[model samples]
Target: MPVSAAALAESLGRVPPSCGPVRLVAVDGHAGSGKSTFADWLARGEVPVVHLDDVATHDELFGWTRRLRATLLEPLARGADAEVPVYDWVARRFGPAVRVPCAPLVLIEGVGAGRAALRPYLARVLWMDVDQETAGAAGRLRDGPELDAFWARWTRAEREHFAADPTRPFAHATVSRRTGGYAITPGPRAVLDPDFSDTA
Candidate 1:
């Protein structure tokens, strides 16, 4: 059966606010695992999303913890709108900043969005539930051969990052692609953690 983003959005909104008055939720997974697309569809231009891609740079793919916390999380934690800096992939530099309102439910969407440092501020984490090899092949195909070098570096870095701080084990939900839409199922954490199990 096809699923609708409306129902998912409604359910996510109910997750308790872990970041001050805002419910900070993370959509994390391997590259090309559809984290961005799912998050965009789920948001439907209504919910606020802070993309990890914007916080990452060519030199520092996973070195965005401090920046994200400082620019986005801190403000949202203070019940204020966040002014997030956008990185220009083409220019390979920081571009303009975008203001993300402190909405009732805010999504942190991108690869590694559910890293250890950000979990405390997140009410829930949704993993894409796709294998790294499959996701990498799809990502490479989407980006084309022109970005082969970049993908090579990125894949290695992603592998290292995940090995050190895996997100799947800590995810509250696992999102998998389904015909016409996606399926959201309880993840390991949701099954293992008493708090999540109680709520479920």
Candidate 2:
């Protein structure tokens, strides 16, 4: 059976708020690993979501930590609304900013959303269970040749980043597509007692 968002939300609600009064959840995985899809399902278009794509630019893909902290995290941590600047990939510039209000549940979805730097303020981290090769193939198929050169550079950068700081081992749960929906399993970092083989 497919896991329900309400059940997951109930679990997340029990984690205690890590970022001010908001329960911050991170959906992180390899590029094209279905993180965005899972996050969409989890949010169900009701909860607030922040896409890291808006914070990343072509020139500084993974180097937007400072910008994220300044614009998103810091404000939320201070119990205030945050203004996120959207980056225009085609124009290669940051466009208008969007204001994100304080909400009970907030999700951040992207490749490095579960990095160590942000994990401290996250209530839970869910890692998508997809290999890089599979993800890369799917990404290429979806994006086509227009992103071929970009993929080459991204692959190398992703490999180096994950090698230095893997997010899977630290994830509270691992999500993978099942027959009809997704299966969320307890990760190595899950706090459940031994022999509890629960799968949602």
Candidate 3:
């Protein structure tokens, strides 16, 4: 059976704590895979989320790994509050620093939130189970022709990046989009030949 969004949120609250007192959950997948929307839905209860989009910049999309480790991960791991850098999409630069308190549950959503370097800090990793082709098509349509070249480059980069450091193999949960909502299930790592059914 598909886990309801409410049930998933409750589960997040119950996840065992890792770094300090924080139960860090990472939502990762191809760009335009509805990770942000799903993360928002998952944050309905008391969990606070750290959107990687805010930490990533136009020039340094995937390069924010070091920054994230320095500003967010390291601090949280040490039971200290972190001041994260917020990137301005329109301005194409990083804005003011925003403080993130070490809460019981905190979600980090982005394309590579489940990267090998970050998995150790996360209590659980959720992969938005959408095909790369579909995600790329959606991204191209969403950004339109103006970003055609950028998308082309991004596609290749994303493929290479994930190939070298894939996250699906380590994911704890998988989620697929439905008509009006989403369908959630434990990942292969958490289940044996799990039968999946759609939900909306």
* Clash counts for all predictions: 0, 0, 0
Residues 1-200, candidate 1: write the lDDT tens digits.
Answer: 43578877877777689998999999999998988899999999999888888999988999999999999999999999999999999998898899999999999998889999999999999999899999999999999999999999999999999999999999987887877887677788873232222221
Estimate the TM-score of every prediction: 0.94, 0.94, 0.89
Candidate 3 Cα lDDT to native: 0.82
Clashes of 1: 0
> Which model, 2 or 3, shows the larger TM-score?
2
How high a TM-score does candidate 3 get? 0.89
| Residue-level lDDT tens digits of model 3 in 1-200 | 55466666666667788667888989999988989888888787456789998987778768888999999989998889999989888888778998888888888999899999887788888899998999989889998999999888888889998999999988887888776677776775663123333323
**Superior by lDDT: candidate 2 or candidate 3:** 2
Regions more than 4 Å wrong, model 2: 191-200
Q: Residue 125 error for model 2, in Å?
A: 0.7
Which candidate leads the pack in lDDT? Answer: 1
Model 3 C-alpha RMSD vs. true structure (Å) is 2.9
Over 16-73, each residue of candidate 2 has an lDDT whose tens digit, in order, gives: 8889988899999999899888888888888788999889988888898899999989
Better of 1 and 3 by lDDT: 1
Better of 1 and 2 by lDDT: 1
